[model samples]
Target: MYPAADTATLLIDGKWLEADDGATFPVTAPATGELIGRAADAGAAETDRAIDAAAAAFGPWSAETAYARADVLRRAHDLMLERAEDLAVLMSTEQGKPLKAARNEVRYAADFLAWFAEEAKRVHGRTIPSNRRGHRFQVLKQPVGVVAGITPWNYPMSMITRKVAPAVAAGCTIVLKPAEQTPLCAVAVLALLEEAGLPPGVANLVTTARPEPVGERLLADPRVRKLTFTGSTEVGMRLAAGAAATMKRVSMELGGHAPMIVFDDADPVHAAKGATLAKFLNTGQACISPNRIYVQRGVVEAFTEALVARTATLSAGPGTSPGVSIGPLVDDAALTKVQRQVDDAVERGARLVLGGTRLTEDGLDRGCFFAPTVLADIDETMLIYREETFGPVAAVIPFDTEEEVVARANDTAYGLASYLYTRDLGRATRVSEALRFGIVGVNDINPTGAQAPFGGVGVSGLGREGGVEGLDEYLDVKLIGTAL
Candidate 1:
């Protein structure tokens, strides 16, 4: 996984071009801080070329029938599944998730392409009712011109597919900027699309270490009709604001401080297992990871015991290692932030039930490894209660009633995903409906998919990313009336 084939060029127009300034950035594995590859550090000029190429490609690309676009996407999907091992290896090397998890992500990424490939054929317009007897009315869904997609490092392959697949399926050309930390994956994805018979310039890639300047250009460009981004809340807001200045259609899948609530009626062990999986998957780096855990007072003790015990079993190591469920934080900053959050939580009266320190022993000294942490007695007064830790730390807060827990869970500026576990169906229904998140998992920790609508409410950012609704984000509607 460490010596994956390194890609070091930008995909502008139909060609792979090196930056004119010859700037490059080193890509190191968070698992060991080992330099795996180098990527071209694109800047404003490269971004401008990518946008211009996407705009030029949009005309012929969008003019193609939906079925044609679907054919290319379908071919890419097959190629991904065919070359799954290579992609998974590269993903593990670059992203620091387990090889198994990387494999799963590769499949999930391919699944998006497959989902949208079939969905593209169903992009249908409709006949509308006419008020006048001698007139006809029609509604049409057309591709929004050029699309600029900015993706994050976590689940790099899947995020790109989740974004680019829909935009392509909707017959829109795109310029993609993958997270600088993991640009090789994006380069690999564009290569697959190229082999899938996608016309050159239909999908351009701009890999850059400096995103602000490149992002500013993408958002400010009048030719880029749509902007889709998946990253931090602060960055997403700034990009959304810039897009608004150009009146661009913007969809942002930003940060989340997801809540997982367990009722007393639930089996404490079962709820704990669900909570462990939801909280620690991808080492708790996922946007939808349950950052906050709420348990009813009657079940809190058993839940905490089970959760702590289960979390202790998660081994944080190189993602390439065997049976390793948890992996290193993506960088030193992430490790520092997780450490700060845990320290703040403990200082504010929360109990560190287990693991509150960074991992430096047992050959973990070189990596950004934090132990799988579990804290109890978390309260609203604690900093961890409000911030998205984005690490493998679970802070448990005990609640008295369903009403109180729901109120506590909804108290967040971010609302991307939430979860509830209860044996009582009525309680589950009532609680699920009460949560103010864009997504709720009732008795289910993993609810999102290629076909599901993935996004958020409030400052969690704008628009949906998956399902038919995702395609709509890359499209514009028009009503046409003709006199008979």
Candidate 2:
């Protein structure tokens, strides 16, 4: 057994501190089914302290030149690179993803830091065409002051970096609240930034089991000028509502039931593989992972066969185990939810193609390992087809024509990301434009990038998280007018 960490430190203001209430939230390893460490449970008072620190530092931190901020971010990026392996292992231990996948997440997380570091210097405001001859209009981008960053448990490191990097790049101080289940990655990042010589109170992290109290307090405080979060739609709505009372700027990357469509003209082999990977990434916990798949009737049989064959070869075990392609869900609650969805679908006449049974006899009987599942003959009545199955589950529905496929894909309330696999350039262009999602991937499983705008429409969430758009979330544009 690996040695358990003595404490999961909370970085508040400029120093690492313990909880004032003396309460500790235990971090459980989903793979080993054991408690790994106890993180400080930040109460309302502690959150206030962190927010105050962030507020106090905002003036100086945001006053720094873009190059200065870029330099500090770059140093932190280099530190992350040097410790990638250890960071990945720690992430896998906490998040229950395969070691290889965890390492990729670490690299992906570092990419955000490095890319945003350079982009910090490029946070440019535009000059508007003169409406009046005497008055010249110049738009200036200024920092949005202290930002409250709330990140989720899945893809812990990447999620935190995605939010924090952009806010820092835009020269905003931050008070971060990482998910209690996976707070270590954020703590690790805080340590790296501390080592990189970031100014005191510029960035602070507080872990709390009661996210509502902490979140409410942070947003309600007038000192916080911007709010960014990545989590469920319900909670996102509540936070957005709270932030609105103060008219604070808010950006959210919420839940998704993204669709993947396979046209009759597409290569079944390639489409099948791509869909499987996209649907199963992070055991299907990703917000943009393909949840509803529409396949053209002509190629449905072939695609189904290819998908089943590929999924059959996947292995499930602890993240450290050799050749383990998938790991357990985050906890028992997640497992129960997935199982209920499958059961409801079956009752609603949806056909289970593979993995209809729970792996109760496996070594992970007590763990949260649900079988990677595929469903067919699904209709709108089934909960599995309508709700977000944030687990290792995929529903395959066949469509007759392009119009039918497009209609079926857009039937859901979510418009986060969509996938279409076809080699035909004309068809690809038309369908990609037709899809309502903010981001559309054609023959690409990895739809997100540091340079791309990441957000969704309808119930998915509001605003954007990455790209130039993300930096805008942490800035206020002011028109500086002068007659020369």
Candidate 3:
């Protein structure tokens, strides 16, 4: 069972205190439409307080030895693993992912903390050659003061860990603004950090119902030296513009309409299984979820049949339910968006082969549950074909040649991730290189790990989030010159 929702207070300056005005908002479970709990609703004043706390703590925190920071992160990682089961259940309740998937997310989140913990000691700088005699040059890497982390609800636990771990490991303090829909998980995570011995004011959390007061203030504040956000492209663009006024460093992991290309040489069953897992994971709420499928014309019919069979095997219900593969959408708005996209696709002449309607039967009427949907004959003109569905809906488009498929896949404004399935070594190397995405999974659906860099290009946003590069996001370079 999951722990009770944390309704005490927001974490600021290393203390748990109520918002200045004591305002609160209700957090409801998407699975059952039940009230999870009420969370502190921090506004402008609370946001400013968190920022001030992070700024005040930044100097001392950044001055600490890398080993010191690494110790704290390691403790936090151990604590998270010890509490993984509870955290996973909490994630399933608040974030609406299946229990199994939620458990994996917690494990994945812990890996980031551990990875960054070791990486803390390895942040290096080098000596530069001087142009003139009697002159010496050296480069040093240091923390970038206070940071504002804005994360989405899709991967609540992992997103927080991904940003917070690296920021702390890099010796930077942070004010985290978690998605309001899943603030309880963020609260739980903050509690773990505190228990793991994070110093006061080094990490803070402010949850607000309104973005203008909290989110906007962080973006516009000069005290926040960096802004790292993971959410929609629309919001990322707005944050980028606002952050520019203060000349703050920015790292954004925005939206993605990832394409999965299945070649004729690939086994139909294996390709279908991979596509199913990729598309339906987390009920397809992932930013990097495969939104579009391009099958070679010669194998399109067989692949479609296999995909329909695989999709039909998935069980959609509450996340806590046994044997449920797909879970509810985050809210009514998400449900409506998915429904609208499917309807538009059908209206544009795409055929729904598998599941297409909302699941209201079997005690799921109150929740935001959508069936695992598959659409065939999808063309570029269809709304589903052009947009990120962000749901458990896959639109399959047939292509006659590899060149044609590559061109169509790269046509999107978003370039976060792409996937290709083939046994041909030459084709794998060629197509993987041709794909204009930050990450490409050839013959594999899951490409993310602690050792690899994760980010995107084009409208998908800027900067990397994992691996050695992720830690660098919170650091700045300083050049020292000496003349004798």
Candidate 1's residue-wise lDDT over 1-484, tens digit each?
1123344469888788777798889999888888988888889999999988898899899999989999999999999999999999888888999999999999999999999999998888999888899999999999999999999999899999998899889989999999998998998898899889998889999988998888889988899998899999999988888888989988989999999998898999999999998898999999999988999999999999999989988988899889998888888899999999999999889999999999998889889999999999999888899999999999999999888889999998999999998888888888888899999999899898899899999889899988888888888999999998
Using lDDT, give the best candidate's number: 3
lDDT of 2 by residue, 1-484 (tens): 1113445366777878878868888888887678877888888999999988888888888889988888888898898899999998898888889999999998888888888888888877788778788778889888889999999999899888898888988989999999888988778888888788788888899988888789989888998998999999999989999999999988878988888989888899899999889988988889999988989889999999999888888787778778987788988888888999999999988888989655655577756888888888777888888899899888898888888788888888888999998879998998899889988999898988888889999888888877878778888889888887
Return the lDDT, model 2, position 436: 91
Clashes of 3: 0
Off by over 4 Å in 1: 1-7
What does candidate 3's lDDT look like per residue over 1-484, in tens digits?
A: 1135355558888888767777888898898989988888888888888999999999888899999999988998999999999999999998889999999999999999899999999999999999999999999999999999999999999999999999999999999999999998998888888888889999999987787779888987889999999999999999999999999999999999999999999998899999999999999999989999999999999999999999999998878788989999988888999999999989999999988889999879889999999999999888888889999998899999989999999999999999999999999999999999999999999999986899999999999999999999998999999998
Task: Give the Cα-based TM-score of candidate 2 against the true structure.
Answer: 0.97
Find the 10 residues in a row with the least total lDDT in model 1: 1-10
lDDT of 3 at 154: 95
What's the TM-score of every candidate structure?
0.98, 0.97, 0.98
Determine the C-alpha RMSD for candidate 3 after optimal superposition of all C-alphas. 1.6
